[model samples]
Target chain A: MIHLYQNNGYNIVLDVNSGSVHVVDKAAYDVIGALEEQNEFHTPDTLKSPETAAYLKERLGQEYAEEDLTDILEAAAELAGQGRLFTRDVYGDFIDEVKQRKTVVKALCLHIAHDCNLACKYCFAEEGEYHGRRALMSYEVGKKALDFLIANSGKRRNLEVDFFGGEPLMNWQVVKDLVAYGREQEKLHGKHFRFTLTTNGVLLNDEVQEFVNKEMDNVVLSLDGRKEVNDRMRPFRSGKGSYELIVPKFQKLAESRNQQKYYIRGTFTRNNLDFSNDVLHFAELGFKQISIEPVVGEDTDPYAIRREDLPRIFEEYDKLAKIMVDREKSGRGFTFFHFMIDLEGGPCVAKRLSGCGSGTEYLAVTPWGDLYPCHQFVGQEEFLMGNVEEGLTRPDIGDAFRGCSVYSKEGCKKCFARFYCSGGCMANSYKFHHSINDTYEVSCEMERKRVECAIMIKAALADA
Target chain B: MKHIKTLNTQTLNNTVKKGGCGECQTSCQSACKTSCTVGNQTCENRK
Candidate 1:
């Protein structure tokens, strides 16, 4: 299957199955479009067939000379011969095999603290309580969680543990102890633990900075953007802005890490439709690694990204891409999270993108040791997959999550971004709709545009 | 960014293991609803 689109003056053709990308001129692009429209593009042999040749001539003859059209057809066919375009999906036979494989838990998002110090208005975890009593993961629970990850992690040598929470810093001591224990186990068990931390910067200080810089593999610092934009949604319980308090600390941590393995994560909402400005502001602040995500909220909520907001949001993405082109040419390039698509060597090359690996392999552990598919599903009891003590008792729910993929989801079957996006976040699918096979339409739209912009940026940079 | 010739390139087919999120290994995916960063595997500090 092939998906064709023109964005930012680049006519990009992507073969969905074989993961080939072609940048074609107008003639070639038009020819592909014509073939796509006629639905005759399957085999290269068919493209050279008499009927297909007549159709191509009838469609593109006026625009191009007959000889040039034939040449374009041959070129497209050559690419097809190389398994680039019109590649058939050979993954159908193995889809069940891949899903039915043993649950190898390689990563776990440990909810170290199910509580937060700030009261961000759009906090999806509802200020880190996750709709449960505020608590912290004791060292014992964290150890059991790590032990479970190792036990279930079949043949995997490297394991990941993300210290996540209302704010992981709220339970700093346990986090430190857990890391120490994980380090001790690494040598005895012959497994390596790569730990990461995500925090709101409320409890970050010189000591915390020093330790994370020394031990943590990666740290995600949360901040929205400019003072007003960030302060509006992410504020303290006292109704004061945390931006002023956190920016300096974040800046310090980023610089200390040399901006290599850390991301300054921000959130955009309807209030900031001009979200590109927030991205630019992050660059202006000297942050090389940055990510600004769209806020997920109820439609009734004031900040929810609604359907009507798509056009402006799409424009914002285009604007950001254009700016990125210029910035890169001037040697001022910075990393934008959504724009960091690997067109060549990423997971798309792997032929199967299982999304966030929520239920089957990557699970979320609450402070009390209860397991959910992922952090987003922590409060939803229906998704509870069991705890660290006894391992996954709800294999049925695990099977349901394992069954989810672009091939199974009706909305994702024809999506160009299917392999790249894997199948979007399953928690989102379950939350916006009752079924995990569904999709959050607004999120899907935004993700599609981002994929386009990301590819555009790649083309622009290669030229530079 | 059209090329003189119809520039076509085949991407590298890296046989990646499945345990890691079939997508790139973006740690930010914890609450990620909209933006899915594709390649998070080759981090500077990841083991």
Candidate 2:
């Protein structure tokens, strides 16, 4: 599939399947469009149209001679033949492979604790306990989860487990024991275990911080920018802001982890339209890796990013891009997680089509040992696959998630940014639209603007 | 496979220019927008 868009006055054509981007002239662009429109309605033998050529010449102000137009059309046909322009049915082989592949659980998000210290207004987990009874994962359940991952991982050598929560740190003992247990199992099972911890930092004392810094493969510290913004959105049940409590601890943890993988993750709401400043604040605070995501929830909420906020949000992204470029120029570059695209070496077409591998390759284990596709689907019993002991009782749910992809989604198939976005968040889709295949339109638009900004950044940096 | 899309010379010229390819070594899974803590590392092998 080919996607066409205008960027910085250049007509850019993205060959989605082949990952090739081209910049063409107005005459070539018009000719390619005309040829594609004709190819859609006619066979290759009758694809060349004298009438369409004449119309394009007139419509494009006759920039190219009749002979030149013919040459351009021929070149476009050659590109199509080479499977770069207007390609169709490119995922047939991929679909076949997916059909035959066995489902394995390679990653597990263990809900270490069901209780959280903070009651963020937009908490998807009903303030971290998943809106059910509060509990912590038992050592037995945690060990069983490890066993489940190891047994079901097939021939995969690297397996991953995340300590997730209302706040994982609340159940710190179980988390520590599980890491040690995973290491013991690694030696016995001949596999490598990658452990990641996501925390709100309210309970991050020196010892907890030290332990995570040493043991966790990746640490995701949750902080939503400045004090006021964070306090307003993410406060304790007592209505107290958490920014003051977590900032110094987060700073120390970030400084201590010399070469380890970590990210200061924040969320932007409608209140902060200029969220770029929040990112800048993190950079100034010496965070080398930062991620500021838009808050996701019901649209009716006053703080949710409404359709009207998109124009300002786009401008904020542009502003952030400018600041990011400036930082690079000054030799003080930091990685903004969202803006960092693998342009030279992105994921394969198959991986892009399949998305984050939530169900087939990954699962989230609740404190009670119940399993779901991912954290977003944890409390929703209908999505429950099974418990660790029972081992995927609802295999059909897994199959359904496995079958989902950008190719299967009607809206995503036509988007130029489909490869990068991977059909958006499935949980968000199910939450807002009641279907995993449907996308959240607001997030879709936001993602497209981000892609445009990313392209602009790439072009500017390449020129420089 | 090589095709040239038209360039808006005026817009291209007026565009602010920057330098360097700011690629990070982290895995795409880690950088995903979703709240899922785990990331996909298959692309790391290709890199």
Q: What is the C-alpha RMSD of each candidate to the true structure, in Å?
A: 2.7, 6.4
CA shift at A112, candidate 1, in angstroms? 0.9
lDDT of 1: 0.79
Give lDDT tens digits, candidate 1, residues A137-240.
99999999999988988777778889998899999999999999999988888888878899999899999999899888888889989999999989999999
As a TM-score, model 1 comes out at: 0.94
Model 2: residues with Cα > 4 Å off, grouped in runs: A8-11, A23-56, A61-83, B1-42
Candidate of highest lDDT: 1
Separately for all candidates shown, the number of backbone clashes (residues 3 or more apart, or on different chains) is 0, 9
Worst 10 residues of 1 chain A by lDDT: A343-352
- Candidate 2 per-residue lDDT, tens place, A372-413, comes to 888889889899899999898998988888777777778786
Candidate 2 lDDT (Cα, 0 to 1): 0.74
